[model samples]
Target: MVTSYVDEATGLLREDGKGSAQFEEVVLHPRVTVADASMAEAARAAHATAHDWCFIARSVNFPVRHEATVAVG
Candidate 1:
């Protein structure tokens, strides 16, 4: 499962009378369920690779953080 958290703050209004907003922070929470506990490391590695390849993560100017968790079931 993957969850995205974005923090935004309102910016100064423009002369056109429009409100502006900017992203302050972005956090991704990825929960990986593996068949075995030994796969935890592999799952984490995969998550890292995916993060690196993500277009949104790369396009954003602000930092994108990850809070990943692995569980065995």
Candidate 2:
């Protein structure tokens, strides 16, 4: 799984303006290698389950998007 994000800040460079920063978006790329192509759906489902159970994902106010890929080896 690879995680990437974008951060946005407002008024940070100004001498008199207050600085605030927050995540604009987060993306999770989950790759699964399975023995057969038929298992791709299961792999994707598992990733969804894991994401639902993740505390950090649930706690974050920003959007957490998933890009799941499955490979048959």
Full-model lDDT for every candidate: 0.66, 0.64
lDDT for model 2, on a 0 to 1 scale? 0.64
Q: Candidate 1's residue-wise lDDT over 1-73, tens digit each?
A: 3233233323332244466556666777766677777777888898788878989879977777777777777
Best by lDDT: 1
Q: In model 1, what is the error at residue 20, expressed in angstroms?
A: 1.8
Q: What is the lDDT of residue 21 in candidate 2?
A: 58
Best candidate, TM-score: 1
Model 2 residue pairs with clashes: none
